[model samples]
Target chain A: MDSENLENINQMLEQDAELREKIKDQVTEFDKKTRVMTGLLNKIHSTPTNQLPALLDSVQPVLYSCSDVTAEIADLVPANQFWRWKDTWCNSLRNAVFVATLIEFLRSESLMTIQQVSDILGIQPSWKDRFVLTAEDYLHGVISLVNELSRLAVNAVTMGDFEQPIKISNFVKDIFAGFSMLNLKNDTLRRRYDSLKYDMKKIEEVVYDVSLRKLAPSTRDA
Target chain B: MAEQPQTGSLKSRTAIVVVFETFRNELDEHNDRRERLIKNSRDVTNLSKKVIFLLHRIMTEDEPTPKPNNDRASRAAAKGREKLKEVQNLFASIRGEVEGDRFWRYQRNVSPGLQEYIEALSFAHYLDTGALISFNQVQQSLSDEHGVPYFPLTLEDYLLGLSDLTGELMRYAISAISQRGGRTIAREVCTFVRSCRADFETLTPYYKELRKKQAVTSQSLQKIEDATYAIAVRTSEYDLPPEMLDDVVAMVSGS
Candidate 1:
């Protein structure tokens, strides 16, 4: 490959690792918050009904924030590749179900509302579909950066992995589910991300601008 | 003469009422139909469970006495039964939602469906990359992988660019309906818009092609549009920035 094509191909692979890493971070965050909420759910199960809302309130932020991000992360992967999430998407998808159920539970006055659970579960596929595409651009790009070193260990030709290769693979079974897409040529990808060496200088500007924070938060802002 | 003048005025007034009533009735009708679609989807989903229960009962029953030494037939029957049951349920659930709702609700709800559809976008990317290299190999070597080039100049990317032409027609229809305020045209526009969402795969390549062609084609198109807008509306030509509006027009035209 010419230097430019090599560069383009390299950029593609780099973005893939970056995307994976970003998702890993988000997933870790998701797991941490969910573990806390899961424990809280158990506590609420025992607490008097009157104290339940307070209990639920504490987890609500976690659920909503986690969900919003997971949904955002879901954008990183394709809805069709819901499988790439492997166990991660499973937990988060279920977590979303639980949170959605919690929302229903709150409204149901605590009577074990399967209706809400089922409703959330039913809509799970739909929600997954909507958020998957947008997420992949973000996901693959971030994952590539996180694993840049691991990638270069191999060669692009006859190599198991490229130092930075662009990929978007889907398990046919997951053909209809999540973002399994990976590409190096997508110019419009990750244009919205406001992070990196560049955004570091803008941290002070971001804090004072509430609207900016609302749209996106740095690791520090989150 | 006075009577004729009164008749004309009365006819005009009635025409006005008819126009007003058509819009009012159409909007109300659309609203009612949308509600019905939602309710029908719910009812179908509920009905699916009952059907599943019946299928399970039938499947669990003892096999027929004639048990043709092979279990394959019976097993295949059971599997088919299960699959059919799922299909029936799926259709029941989505039937109303897909077929009956008015245009606005469809637009609102359709985004979720579009999201799902677009999520598989990487597949297209993968295919394009693989095909590009494979076709290049076939053409370069004239090897057994023999065939015309994949996504050749006039093939893959061409259709991709051409879809932009359709999208422009779509935008024009939308603006026309919005400006004219009649369901007759609006209904057609609604189909155009919904097709943009529902049948995206059919359009994806075309849209992709259009996007590619945009780089070269947009400059001229924008100049034409800007000049037209400047003269027709007597607005400042500078208001519509060339690069921005050109792409916007290209995108709108593609959809």
Candidate 2:
């Protein structure tokens, strides 16, 4: 090899190693934040429906810390390499979105929008930086939220919150309708969306069981 | 499109919704293009495999005996050429759908097929001309039939494919070892593989996949050397006297 070629190879090797090390650090930070968010979300899963707001409030500090680390990751990753590392960082954001949306559903009995989740997570709309999460990433997060809500609907009936299942059933069906309008080609997201129908079906079953027995919230509360 | 939301939350909500709608459209188009490219490339890969099989048959039937009128091997070579043409056509269809940045994005989908085709084409070229096919020759053969710009195969794909071509050459060397001029063929292959290994070492740092392949290429070169050494030892056993036998063995083994 020529001396020029040898010099070029040396430079490239150094650059590749540096980029890999930086990405590893960012991925580690993202993983740590994701763990905190998952821990908080698990608490919501076990907490009773009526006491969800209080449970969420207790984890408020952790939510801010998770988002802070996410922002740091966004700043650290270069724009061009974002696609390669997207699955890693977006997975972390997906967990955060899942928990934030669940907290929103419990508090207002309504669907949480992407903007709301971003607000909850303290994520800046880093459109110019371009390393921040996209709406599509949050959509994936919402898809996971739909899956969790289906299980929540069944559990709510057992917890004597029959009315919550009705709200969840409606919210999930609405999200499914919105998703169906999109021409989705991402196989992973498409497959996940296909299972939304099953979640809708399960929620419907829970709603039917509650209604037929007059065990719904309106009747019991009255 | 009714638009009356001036509040910060509502404005950002609208933006997110609009962005997602655009993103979904882009994803749909990208997936469609990717799937189409993969389908065409797989056809190319299958055809290329058939071409390699034909080449293997041709080599197997080629013997030193006076059966020079054996039409079957030539017929198989002819059929392999036709299959290679079909591969070129299939690749043309893929090239039509992808260009510029799209080519780079979908490269991973078609790279394996392209590399396999390269191995087959190079093997066939070597058999016919007793010369290594150049990258320019591969490019010229793949010229677009539709009068469009010729699709140039990326150097990365070509080099990767050429690396795999060594494995095919290794297989050929192993089978030819029992025939006349077999040791020479094995020696030539060992030299070629060693040169390829040296060329790739300079490129390894830039490509992680290439680094892995270079390691495999080194092992392949070693195997060819070992095979030739066995042939030399066996040949020397018959021609040399006991005192001279040890010296001949040492020379062959050292080389």
Best by DockQ: 2
Q: Per-residue CA lDDT of candidate 2, range B61-144, in tens? A: 655452332243355456667779888878877765665434545668888889999989888766665456676667777786
For model 2, which pairs clash?
Answer: none
Interface DockQ of each model: 0.01, 0.08
lDDT accuracy of residue B69 in candidate 1: 16
Candidate 1 local accuracy as lDDT? 0.37
Candidate 2: docking tier = incorrect
What candidate 1 gets wrong by more than 4 Å, as runs, is A1-9, A78-87, A102-222, B1-255
Q: After superposition, how far is residue B115 of candidate 2 from its true place, in Å?
A: 2.9
lDDT for A97 in candidate 1 is 49
- What's every prediction's RMSD, in angstroms? 33.3, 8.5
